[model samples]
Target: MADREDKNAENVAGKFYVDSQCIDCDLCRETAPKNFTRADDEGYSFVYKQPESDEEREQCIEAMEGCPVEAIGNDGED
Candidate 1:
């Protein structure tokens, strides 16, 4: 489970976030390109945007479901 307290600094202020447990995987980026991104220099992923539509929201959920380390969080404030 992702620790909100340890969420990545690059994540925007939103319900979706990536915590320090992220392993720099690209699955979230591939699954929700509009909402997730990577900082190659930092070797981590973060939520760059919040979902704006039902489809986007589902995609973000999929990304979180597919995450191997459960680094993605969707319960934070918007």
Candidate 2:
């Protein structure tokens, strides 16, 4: 279980992270469609890519803030 968790974490690194508390609101996708997409099973937002440009980064930040459940965050401290 620990190894699986670690692998999952690694796969999602450098991208947007949705904590277990996510409510599947889809605000992140609405805010940053290019970088976030809805998961088919849960309808929760997941990162499509780690933003590289200033505009994309700003969009990600907005998505993080707009999340009703506060589910979205960068992989590490900002």
Candidate 3:
């Protein structure tokens, strides 16, 4: 599970986020490219955009569930 407190600062203000535990895996990015983006300096993936449609949200959720290190999170704050 991803901790809100430990989530990456680059993450956009939303329900979905990526934590510091990210291992720079491409799973999330591959799973939801629109919602997830790479941080070149840190070499990690973070949620850069919130899903607007159901399909997009589902894709984001899939990416979160598929995260190898469980770095992705959905706290439903947005």
Candidate 4:
């Protein structure tokens, strides 16, 4: 599970976040391009944007589910 304490600094303030456990696998990025993006310097992924629509929320959920390192987390915020 992703640890909020370890959440990537680049992640936007939101319910969803990516943590330092991320392995840069590109799964989240490919799964939810709008929300997840690469931190080129750190070689990890972070949530750059919060979902704005039902479809985007679904995509973010999918990305969270697909993260290989379990680095994605949903804090259940709206």
Cα lDDT of candidate 4 equals 0.93
- Candidates in order, TM-scores: namely 0.95, 0.73, 0.96, 0.96
lDDT of 1 by residue, 1-78 (tens): 988889999999989999999998799999999999999899999988899999999999999999999999988576
For residues 1-78, could you state the per-residue lDDT of candidate 4 as single tens digits?
A: 999999999999989999999999999889899889999999999999999999999999999998888999999876
Alpha carbon lDDT of each predicted model = 0.92, 0.65, 0.92, 0.93
Over 8-76, each residue of candidate 2 has an lDDT whose tens digit, in order, gives 232246645666556767777777777777667765556767787899889988988777766776655
- Tens digits of per-residue lDDT for model 3 on 1-78? 999999999999989999999999799899889899999998999988999889889999999899988999999897
Q: Please identify model 4 stretches exceeding 4 Å from their true place.
A: none
Ranking by TM-score: 4, 3, 1, 2
